[model samples]
Target: MNERNRTVVTEFLLLGFGKLHNLRILLFIVFLFIHIMALTGNVLVVVLVVFNQSLHSPMYFFLSQLSLSEILFASNIVPNMLWLILVEGGKVSVDLCIRQFYLLAAATITQCLLLAAMSYDRYVAICRPLHYAIIMTFTRQLQIVIFCWLMGFMLSLIVYIFLDELDFCGPNIINHFYCDIAPVLELSCSDTSSVELATFLESFPVVLIPFMLIIGTYISILRTILKIPSTIGRQKAFSTCSSHLTVVCMYYGTLTSIYIFPPSNNSVDANKGLSLLYTLVTPLVNPLIYSLRNHDIRRTIAKFLGTL
Candidate 1:
């Protein structure tokens, strides 16, 4: 890694499913459809939560924030993916790639934090019903949401700052659809051990700690549900959490698979597929999951649709 032999790389060629010669156009169409649907669904949720007084609880507020973060997350990745699809292999400037990486990281980390916060909200509602009102005040919810966003950006900023120290010498090719951290690091000629170590250590608090919080909260919630003498009461309480739990499993399962325990062969294709689940599929389906499972969202959506 001699500086004299190092050549500066100003742009990266994203080899995004370029081998799918027969399916490039088809992939583009499918991804475009997903992008549109996911955007529309998340936007509707945000609008409903903002305008509908009935949907103004801490849970709904967190849902709206999750939707907003998903919107940002998907937007940061999908457009570039679509471009890569059409071009077969798209080139992106280093500066633009760094920006995309930062935004994607921030949005996703924000969503993770929001999900943890949502679980805490549910725990308060189910386990401490009497104190729910006093515990999750409007100001407190706002503060929690703000903290999630701030922590997300600050953590991502630390990683972004590390990228500044690395040098991409040559072979400016990223095997994934977008500029993810691992793929970008692979192309760098610098000693990326520190960067890799930082990311690994960072994932603990960023991913594991929040995930563990959710698990602990849910365990308490489950205990509270079991204490209810009536079967109907238990079912009713479980219903409150089932949707969030479903989303949590789906989001974290794919995320941990790709990042925390990346594939043995370092299969870029496998990572891309998993990435699609959280980025495209989850965002599109999240609204449907919540709207179908929650009576309030369904009723509001039904009434809103009936008028149109």
Candidate 2:
């Protein structure tokens, strides 16, 4: 390759959503509403957990972490997306693109592991109630959270570093809203076999392993629920798991659609839409789901509100 050919591209044009000039304002207003809801809801969860002494349990600890992760995850994509749609006219620099991709992937992977950890916490709480305190102590939860963040960043960093080195001398238009790996790869001039392989290998544990563990935990939880003799007992158990299950289904469902199916130009567009469900909608729904269904969170919020 010539030196001129090796020159790095400076910026990238995000072909976000579509160029329906007439629909730009409509899209902007819709996204603004979603973004505001996402931020407010997640932040409320964090504040409630922080201020409520009664909610200082292992489960709520993890729940707060998940909310924080969701906030970070949404911020990585939504603000930039809103900027593109409204201010920058849907354009982003190459460095900014890579940074966005890295943050999005890192936050997403962290949430996956955090959910699994929360499930494990629930498993221990339900299946081994007496030992839950010893097993899921503050130190232990901190360790798990730290490990999740570190592992997620390390894995995503490898992919981002490799992608930075790849030549993107072909089409500069990214067909999706944000700087996702699949869409970015489609624009690369150099071969992406290595990057694809790396993504698959690195993403396996981040996705499948945690997914299996969550399923196993829930199965065990369900078996325990069935063994309960009282109707109220079963209902209580179901309520505890329901919100988490709802969030999990919404998140994993969209993620599976994006990854399990092969990425194409059309798939990229579809993926962006699906990404909104988990990245934006799920966060907005999470606090509401937990607050409405989980008695603990509701009580905490009510009590906190009363003090004001």
Candidate 3:
């Protein structure tokens, strides 16, 4: 905390998922497979949405953006993780670590806000069909998407600027696979009370506000679904809402578990695994969930494949 005690760390050693000497090759293969699938699946979705005229709608437009964001998100962490797993000595410089942290934070926050916006779009479609078009116009959708990206960028900038000023002296090992804010903060020699408090304060609103919005939208949607006159109509509406709800639950459940709950002696492993779900598994599942459950997406895929 004092000038005499201050020291700067030039590089960081990542501990990664685990250090099973015998299972390094196996872990590499598993993560490599996931990285490939994440890339291929997300890329296919982006390409399909871009090329297929039939897939161009407010929903798919958002889906395309989500797919692109997921691709960028996974790329920011996974590849470096893979390199660390494979190479004998993979060390990251201080500047590089900060850059990775900035990008990862930016992509993640963007995805969270974008997903929340998409949920609202679905709510308007199912809950207020009459006003759906008026509420979610093309211009308005574009504006929302831009706002999401801008907010994410600004938040990441704030956090990273604070991080840049921190001095990391000795014990340069990061416990997790990627360079996250918390783990990085733990290594700093400087007074991190302000930084830690800022992180917590910023996280509260960013995490909860979008979460509350998504929940409120879905509640309205559920009420509308129940009010449908005929049983068949009710069944159809429920089926439609169920898929989106499932994805939302999986995403928000894991996300909240990681961010909302404080890190405890017993909860670190649980937190890491939950982080994997949102970072690796959720992106892989999003396209499959949408394609399997949504008739329009399935039909569009079929029609697109038929021509190809």
What is the per-residue lDDT of model 2 for residues 176-254, given as tens digits with 9 covering 90 to 100? 6788887788878788998899888977799999999999999999999999999999988788888888878877888
lDDT (CA) per prediction: 0.90, 0.83, 0.80
If ranked by lDDT, best first, what sequence of candidates would result?
1, 2, 3
- Give the C-alpha miss distance for residue 122 in model 1, angstroms: 0.5
Residues 106-205, candidate 1, lDDT per residue (tens digit)? 9988988999999999999999999999999999999999999998999998888888788888799888888888778888888888877777787888
Q: List the residue pairs that clash in candidate 3.
A: none
Candidate 2, backbone clash total = 0
Per-model TM against the reference = 0.97, 0.93, 0.92
Instruction: State the displacement of the C-alpha of residue 261, model 2, in Å, after optimal TM-score superposition.
Output: 2.2
Compared with the true structure, model 3 gives a TM-score of: 0.92
1 or 2, greater by TM-score: 1
Clashing pairs in 2: none
Q: Model 2, residue 208: displacement in angstroms?
A: 0.3
* Worst ten in a row by lDDT for model 2: 261-270
